[model samples]
Target: MRLSNLIPSIPANVVACLEVQGIRTDTDLLFSTTTFDIYKRLPAGTATLEELTEYTTIAAEIGAAPGMSGHELLLLENTYGDVQLRTGNAELDGLLRGLDGRWIIELSGDKGSGKSTVALNLLINHLASNLEDTALWIDTTCDFSPERATQFLDATQTLPSTLERLQVSLAFDIDTIQGILETLSRPNDPRARPRFLVIDTITPLLGPLLSAVSAQGHAIMTDFMRQLQTFAQASGTAVFVINNSSRKGRDTPERKPALGPSFALLTDTTLWLEAKNDNNTEDSTEDNTVHTMQILKSRSAPIGGCCTFRIHGNVICPT
Candidate 1:
């Protein structure tokens, strides 16, 4: 809806000022720009915080104004109503209760730990489902394989139409990555809005600078993560960020994510994946390699619980 229509009571001059700032619609005002930013764009002495808050409240109400009652929301929660997509692995699905669009899920693991494989599976499942949702994948590792995705599609017998719904982009640096995310955060077309966003190995883009304790790097990282979180909350898009793990010590058993504790704390849910056996030899074979996914943190469910799954020909399956 147009901004003018949503806030008809606002002065025409103020609305025109907002329009001049490229915020002509409610979606643009709410998702594309911040209130303080918008206020700065308006004419002097014409904008007020109270007015901006009112406009935001109205926009939010309009977005969720489907007349859903408290009891109905409760009923939906009982039926896993918030689940937007499934991983197809029963045990993993049970642990995650399916992917919720409202939360950010972080998948961190050691090298060759099937983080990309699991993310690709989720994208495939999201598009293959009956919902009208679409997905956006940002590949930073340059390892996203369409051929492997095709393997998944062929396995599930999904038509070519499903593949068409998945949009993919590659970003090699922090600036490019942030640009892609910011663009997705305020999509111009409603149909083009993504329901799922996947960033493969986010740590690689920011890890080096962060490790060196670069203040500028930290500032950029902070802005990027904050924008990402805001986008997830405002758009209700399920986000999956792949992070690489760092071995703590040669003798120590613990491994930490490359993004470190600060980044981990920002996510709503964190899943850490590791190979089950450290003693497994090179001839262990693909089928013999079992990975365990443990919930390091979760806001809506019990933590410390884990599930085991294996990767077989691009498919993540419960063992």
Candidate 2:
């Protein structure tokens, strides 16, 4: 079943792939056995990957020598690298950033909270990091504004040319957004890795759509969210969603409500952004901002902290 001899020109990642997939021996069955699942299960553990180069080199050589199909040659090259994946965000840098693969980051708070601004800030960060990177902004309420793009960078007091590079597919509904994400998540497509994805709010995907179609609409929204999760997981891109805080009971304490149970279950991190009580507009003057932060949940680290931020000119600046 060994393909290494036949694909002697392969890279180590390929050779190691074949060997680990039980393809180390010569046989017709090797082709059948070395399927998608076999390659998917290939361990990318540090120690195991260290020796991939030597083996992949041998296999790739054979693939290159002559009669291999382009598709077959592609597989050899595609599967043969030590890919250092990136999250394309500064706040969630290092291992915690893109590790979750299909991470859902939710920003939830009452009205006037800077949740949307913070999400936009990340969107800018994604663009600043890579000009080629794309971002999707799903505007359920028609609130997405290019004019407001400068607001997220307000602290800088100046807008840069790169800000215009924040590519977006403005989706007015859940289904529209769902369709766009599906196209972006297809494997082997260069457009799959957008810099950031923003769901302005999940309510439009749930309530409004559900009311019109009843239970069926609710089910469709649910499926759409699942698809979002799948897209995030496979592409290793960031998923950001703004959520409206649930209403509090009349007699209930002003304490904030936990986000939807399902949100906590699916997102890698959940952050709450709420402004402090405005004692006076001019009195606080710590750059005239008073946004507070709390890590509602974090799988990568201790989900805890407080951060003060404000929109100086148009952007959210950490104070």
Candidate 3:
């Protein structure tokens, strides 16, 4: 019964999740058929039968041992009120807290700016912080693949509970898109019960919702946003709406970002993603690619301040 036997057959991820619940050591695990199935699949014997028995017995004992601890719960006191903003970036984490009630974190930039990577990184971190809260991610396009998510988890060192908290609605229809969010916002829905929502690339959903012209588009936009805002406020949930920038034409550097003015008004914060070329093609010192991000509109903090980040596989790192 060597510890090494538990290596492959059992997904490190399963054990990892339990570890976050303060069940770090193997002795803390609650033994059950699920545990046996997982470990049995590993090499013949990782830990001796005696060791496994002891671990399970302790797990059951700990389970019966409790009143709740206050820290594990999320801050839902603001449920259905104003949206609050917090930066996942440790650097700005302190600077940004409770900035606004309705926030929009827009990730934009040329290709490979690590825009999606950053979004996933923040989410993983958020999940690790609130393991009990259930969260939903609506991917209008198939962009939000689980494989990609796993990569990000490893990179950010996100806990298993955080990863499990997420329930993704993949490749949804144009019409059925917002319904995913609306339904989750419903009081009884388990996923939305935690008040966390993420609509990756909301444009696809907007396609069906937008009306004929300028005025109509504006009306639909506002009403739609209002629903999101109201639901977010009432529920104490943190929503991350990720979007891409358009290729309207790069006339001016200042006008690089492409977002409708009306749409911008509804958000409490916006982050613009951009790429900083470091390849030898232009200035060949290091054959590396660097993506830069900027706080386009904080509505509460410094503007134009840029931060460089990297998405190596699923991990987003400070470049």
Candidate 4:
């Protein structure tokens, strides 16, 4: 909290000037008075009003959450790495090297590929493991089904009260989802904070923004994605965003994530889901289909790790 901690950001002379005014810590710089007042109190030309404003902004950010050193970050990973959140399927969890901590995991696939099924499975498994833990599901397509979630919860033997911890919000626009993220990023009771957040098909919310005539939409999309990363890091919550796939290029049958290349870099990992066969084969039951979830991108784990599973009676089962 020492004013020197913001060195290089707040110039040495500026820090000295502020220190002369008894504004030593970030809290003092922020709470002593408005940024303009601080500028007025400073010796003429010691620092510009614009410069003073920028310094205070940086101070506020540091106060909210300071940067993590490399060693500290390594320790954090080691601590949370052992407690990966299950995808509700053992094989799938092992295949992806286990998901943990504050990172974005994207699920992208075509319609009928069972993206929602996988998301619900993950949410139920997380909520069932602990009674006090909470999760948020932002439904963008109005396709989130409580009946399907009920099936998953039942399979996990999640207590009836666990359902209370899984809160779902219908968000069809970027603003609504952004507001939700901002709200979650604020300080709250540790037990009340959500440990996992799912945006069921982010495609609906971001697709138009990326396809607009003006280039401003792209900027908006970038800002929103960064906001997501900030929220994840601030709260140590694992974010899962679902996306729909599109053809890799205009003249190709191969498919890729729909949000384009920028979005790919924004997420920590991307999982592509494909349904090999959805129809009931002669050997299969009425409600069963073999699906493969493949890792498209990862920082720590190797890419292209594909795991197979099936939806039997709405429950995801490892093959």
Which numbered prediction scores highest in TM-score against the true structure?
4
Off by over 4 Å in 2: 1-102, 151-159, 190-192, 208-221, 253-259, 279-281, 284-287
- Best to worst by lDDT, what's the order? 4, 1, 2, 3
Q: Tell me how many clashing residue pairs each candidate has.
A: 0, 33, 13, 0
Q: What lDDT tens digits, residue by residue, belong to model 3 across residues 35-145?
A: 555445444445555655555554454323233244423333423444333335554443345344435455656556666666666566656765556667777777777
| Model 3, TM vs. native | 0.62
Which residue segments of model 3 deviate by more than 4 Å?
A: 1-89, 92-102, 171-175, 188-192, 207-214, 247-255, 279-289
What does candidate 2's lDDT look like per residue over 1-319, in tens digits? 1343344344446556556654553332223443444445666552243344443444444323135477965664464321222323234333233333346777778876777766776667656655666667777777877767765455444447766666656666655675576456444543346646778877555655545335655455555666677777555567877877775666875645243455456566777778787725666554455667677787754666555555554455433
How high is each candidate's TM-score? Answer: 0.70, 0.61, 0.62, 0.74
Model 4 TM-score (2 dp): 0.74
Higher-TM-score candidate among 2 and 3?
3
Each prediction's Cα RMSD?
7.7, 14.4, 18.1, 8.9
Better of 1 and 3 by lDDT: 1
- Model 4, 13-65: lDDT tens digits are 99999989978667679886889888899999897888889889988885575
Q: Scored by Cα lDDT, where does model 3 land?
A: 0.55
lDDT of model 4, residue 224 = 81
Query: What TM value does model 2 have?
Result: 0.61
Q: For model 4, where is the 10-residue window of minimal lDDT?
A: 76-85
